[model samples]
Target: MKPDIRGRQPANRRQKGAAAEEAAAQHLIQNGYRILDRNWRCRTGELDIVAEKDSVLVIVEVRSRSGSSNFGTPSESVDRRKMQQVRSTAEHYLHVKKQYGRPIRFDVIAVMLNAELTTASIEHIPNAF
Candidate 1:
């Protein structure tokens, strides 16, 4: 297994990311967002979360990283290519679900986990795209 710059194993990083995504999902649920799907995927790409608030469908891209990592903030990691892939994946989801004419928006949930990976700081950006 490859070790990160800080000597942490790759599996540890994956575990941290998964934990962060779970926390982000729970945070959204507590904020009145109904989760429709998690890890929805298509030929284009994968969406981290699909949720709804009121009548609007929200596609959420979850970005997660350790607090002391060199990867920069989670939000900064979602670059233009990532946004494009997310947009394409959302289109595929809409077509497959036959969810036409419904209001849609892209969102981003940035999660920063503590050193122990138990606590998280979450930033929700609605209409991110």
Candidate 2:
């Protein structure tokens, strides 16, 4: 018997994540954020969202999990390692965009969905790191 060594996320989960990102983007736009990019990637890593508001460059991390518990809140999912990766990745992005001397901040948007796939809760933490 062979083993499932791919370690890939299920299609449904990927879809849910994509939906969450889109929702997050909309929320940001409504809140006066100008989205610069979505799913920006490089050899270092992938950034879920990049935006600007009030002349400040913002790096947003979106996380979504379907459940009824707060145990897996999105903010809790971003650990120190992930923050470090984000920092390096953001540097790469800034260099690529030639955005030197711009104030930058990291933000997090957490989405919790109901069993029916409806939005249950959303929390946006700005200047998270």
Candidate 3:
């Protein structure tokens, strides 16, 4: 397991993150959201999922935790600083994409994965911010 730049997380962490994001996206799709983007990145940060539902643009932040819930729930991990970063990134996306004057909503999709990473349970919170 190769460490990332700061040597804090192993490469498998990324794989798990990707898997969690995929699960979150599928959950959204099943709920009638049209996915516009996944892993949208810019200088500020990354937006995990961008979707549209009922003419409202939804910015989804996907969070996941595996194994025991010793630390906390996944959605609880998104603190104030992270919310600022997501808002900044979303602004950048809106300006770049020229999507102006559209209703927007922020959502959080929390996924809990089993130890073996075989299944995921998801909780979708709309207007999370």
14 Cα displacement, candidate 2 (Å): 0.6
Per-residue C-alpha lDDT of model 2 across residues 1-129, encoded as one tens digit per residue: 233367544347777888789889989999999999999999899999999999999999998888755576777999999999999999999999999999999999998876456678889999999
- Candidate 3: where are CA atoms >4 Å away? 1-11
Model 2: per-residue Cα lDDT at residue 26: 89
TM-score on alpha carbons, each prediction: 0.88, 0.87, 0.90
The Cα error of candidate 1 at residue 53, in Å, is 0.4
Clashes of 3: 0
Displacement of residue 77 (Cα, Å) in model 3 is 0.2
TM-score of 3: 0.90
Candidate 2: the clashing residue pairs are none
Q: Which ranges of candidate 1 are over 4 A from the true structure?
A: 1-11
Candidate 2 residue 72 Cα shift, in angstroms, is 2.3
Better of 1 and 3 by lDDT: 3
Order of candidates by lDDT, top first? Answer: 3, 1, 2
What would you estimate as the lDDT of candidate 1? 0.89
Steric overlap count per candidate = 0, 0, 0
Score residue 99 of candidate 1 by CA lDDT: 99
Top lDDT prediction, candidate number: 3
**TM-score ranking from best candidate downward:** 3, 1, 2
